[model samples]
Target: MRLSGRAALAVGLAGAVLAPVTPAFAAPPPVTADLRADVDRNGRVDITGTGDQTGEDTWSAGRGAVFLPNIDDDAKRCRTTGPDGKPLSDAKLAKCNDAADTTVNGAADAKDLARLRTVPMAQAPKDASGTVRVTGKGAKHARLFIKRAGGWTAVTAKTTLTAAELRAGVELGLEGTDVVRDRAVWDGSAVVELKVTAGSTTTSDKVTLHVAPLLTQHHLQRAQRMLVTEIQGKGPFSRAQQKFVKDLDTQAKKAGVKQSTVKFTKYGDIWAQDFVEPAYAGMTGEDGRPRTIRIMLRSAQPDREAGRELFEKLRGPDMGVVQVTGVKDSEEWTLNSMGNLETIPPYTHGGRSYPAGRIIMGERKDTGSKPAKAMRTLLASQGLQNPLFLDTSWLHVGHVDEFVQFLPAPGTPRGWRIGVADPDAGMKLLRDAKAAGHGKTKMFSVKGFEGMPAPKETIDQTLADKKLRADNALAAKRIKANLEVLKRETGVTDAEIVRVPALFTRGTDEGVAADRMPLLRRIGGSADTPEAVREYGQQRELGKPTGPSVMTSAYVPGAVNGVLLGPDRYLAPRQWGPVIGGKDIFTQAVTAAYRKAGFKVSYIDDYYTYHLGMGEVHCGTNTLRDTTKPWWRP
Candidate 1:
């Protein structure tokens, strides 16, 4: 009956479809002023920027408009908060100046102000002054900024503008990145109105605010730039990790995407993609082109302080990095959130086309341990991606990127296909290699790390291990279960799926350590434990469906979990399968699969770096793509 903004925005994050545009509250109160903005792509804020001259009342007929919240400048460190507003180190000051931002409730930078769409009130007679006001339940969380010679001033509810101030500029901004504030997730819907009177003439105009969905993925493959951590720390594996960064630069150049490397001199966290994801929000303007903004979303689980500082390092023009955190530390299990959350490419499913695709995360069907609630709520509030929950409780790391990925398939119905792990195919590949007389060839014949020697086993020996074989069989079964969920949700059939060669083994003697278990679990008992490591008393009592100790891991680098370079290039983790003659049989299989699907495969050696850490190329790098496509319908 009523368009309750709070109730509508608070819908369940799992298996929930957010309405792209929340309709105006049933029969809004009559507007009393003239508050104009560039609602149309005509390059000017005027009355003609609408389907009809009824102003915001005609929003349903034509309401394609939006503005960035502008909180991304908080990317770098608090350099301005230093002594005398100066940093101790000159280099640190330089870094801060590059991304120099304002206070939390301060004015926007020059670039940010430019990108912020204009909010101009109707011009009044020569000496006439007026007051511009914004109201509605959605107005509380956003600020209506007014510009002056000193700086831009922020007003939340309402403000009076002198004739000169009105002419200077007036704009709106979000107080913070998250749509879900302490109370409600505010969908950008505020009625802006202005009252002006002169020579016995009083008039007004009103319009509705347009909100843009902060989106990620498939679009990220269209990244203008790519980034990976520069692991400068000295270690036995440092050289190999540095080589990995070089490899990323090489691939980026080949793909024509700019490569950015951050000095991880302190943290040495080479898993760049895990800490942050690339996203964007914008609206088309009068020039028949998109007014784009580059953004990065830092993961909710701030396990690494380096990640937060890294956000400050990554901030640039029209670009910002943000993290929506909770009041307290997120559950340790939520560490999987960033890696688990990924997007499927644009596709039509069940007679509907998702031009911007869907948001997916690795979550259990019955179990409740997942990403932070605030993080999920913020994502779902965007509305473009109807987020889905896939079962990944079977994994040791519990990430979706480990086993499943989306590829550009021009020939497929949706112009894309899902690449998923197939343990059976892996076994078949090994069996075929052995049958070809390479059974005696060493499987991991090369040293994975500098000090550690390669596993002293041949293909024949590995195949002989009944437990290893059984591990793969069970892994394949679980993969299929998640695949079925994907099929049902995305309308993807077997024809649209690509089977990737993958082997599995129980990695650690105890799969998930007692420390990694989810918080608030009753396990073999019925009491909620809110702390991380204290949740599970004994590792064997972990309430995992695959028994207590089965933490399935990729026996070799899984090819599906690789970095995607758009227009047909893929960077897969180098498969260290048995080398027969000049080529590795496993490498040959992986290459053939991707090559057949119209993508050229480049092997990235992660054995010493990420593979040893139970990750691959995709886990090590993050991409920012071209996402200016209009997500709203006519």
Candidate 2:
């Protein structure tokens, strides 16, 4: 990968040949004026032709342009505030990677400067002076910086700066002022060119640049640091949650991955992966080092600054944080949350394989619940992972991850296979255990776990509940339909997919539509207190038609929602299952299923912490995987 452009002066640059762009003026202006951007995104600007050639002038997928993201790549301590008296500057949320503030002393930092291309005058007359500007629909939204004196200084469009040395060259860097708000609003396109006039002649070269696409994911996890929220208190999070942290720490350390914990107890949602997308743009520097960015999802879950908070904590070197928000108070709000997001590992279907794999998110079947227009547009624009959707409307939490997971399978032909919830399989496992004379075994039978009361019911009593049976049956039907969708999209055979033993139970309409949803809510009192949620899903409520007739939560914390330590090591939430002879039947079944897929599994007891809270181990912890793979290669 090398950046190629035209019109390099005789500065004795060895590699590329001298190719001057055609001057617009009739008379030769004492020198040929040329502006070279990284038209070919190999990381450096190499002059390849004499004039308007493909790689030098145009931008395309493989080798035509440069890619930079609308990300927050620079910051510092500034005790200032925006309109809302928050803090003046959080260097993290602030995307303006420039020096100083106001309209005065701001200059582009060195790292941010390197992220973009440098449009320099290759070979111009020493006296040759001209004006440079950005043109196109998004021209004004981008800033042009001139490298002079000490550092890079931001210059307005068509700004005439200091004279060129005409010996080496003059460097002018281009930086994106904002992210792609929406495809309809701005499409990330701009052209930086130069018009130098010396005596009578003037010439220019235009190279188009597309704001970088957010690259998708692969199965191989090279964890830099594993993240888990550590909040132990009386309110929402309990001692069980702390125990979950300890368990995850043990697992992470065993896998040779470092683990970090978030001490902030503001938000109740412990799913770190939901707020912070472990994302990377797959763009390399001039030295071939890969750049990664954590694109925080602009989620609207009570606290609006969920984006800002995650950005502040997670942003670091080469890893910037970007938040593309959406229409407030709409389906775009909850649907765009990262809990609903999952990446289908690289697979071939109908002879076509996605190199970056495909991004899969949940959407409503009856009344569509998709991501924000800006987010959907940005995700689709990535080109590698063509996003596909499934009907997660039936889920009370409404996330694809609850039922589906893509695990790395080295023994398989595709190198990965689907690990999905099988309600029927779960029911069968229960029946089988019962048939083996374990029908009277009591469940939720762990000794000293804190939080919700362990349901003191036998397997016989659980199977006898009409409501529970109906709910799991509904879940089974829905899971089958979802599986069909997955099978059609990615050419995975039934044999290749592993069926996890998982069950579901319906929750009330009141719980689903609450301000702070997805809680480990269990109403006290009544014969079957926890199971007695006033179920409502069929009808349209408050003009937002929730199409699914039955919406349900995991009766047994869906084992499919487990986290991966690596391709071969898996961490699953412990099923506080009924003991038969010596082991929990549910735990044994879950372990067996994963082992069949070539994964060594260890169970983390998330019963009181995440299971009761409508989540599991994967929800409580997030991994920043090694996504430095070739964006264009499978």
Candidate lDDT scores, in order, read 0.62, 0.63
Structural similarity to truth (TM-score) of each candidate: 0.78, 0.82
Q: How many residue pairs clash in all the candidates, one count each?
A: 11, 7
Backbone-clash count (model 2): 7
**Positional deviation of residue 570's Cα in model 1 after best superposition, in angstroms:** 0.6
TM-score of 2: 0.82
- Ten contiguous residues minimizing lDDT sum, candidate 2: 531-540
- Candidate 1 residue-wise lDDT, 469-559, digit = tens: 9889888988999899889878888998888899987744444323222211222132221122122111222333332356576778888
Residue 589 alpha-carbon offset, candidate 2, angstroms: 1.4
| Model 1 misplaced regions, further than 4 Å | 1-33, 41-44, 49-62, 74-81, 84-129, 146-185, 198-203, 285-288, 327-337, 351-353, 512-548
Q: Top TM-score: which candidate number?
A: 2
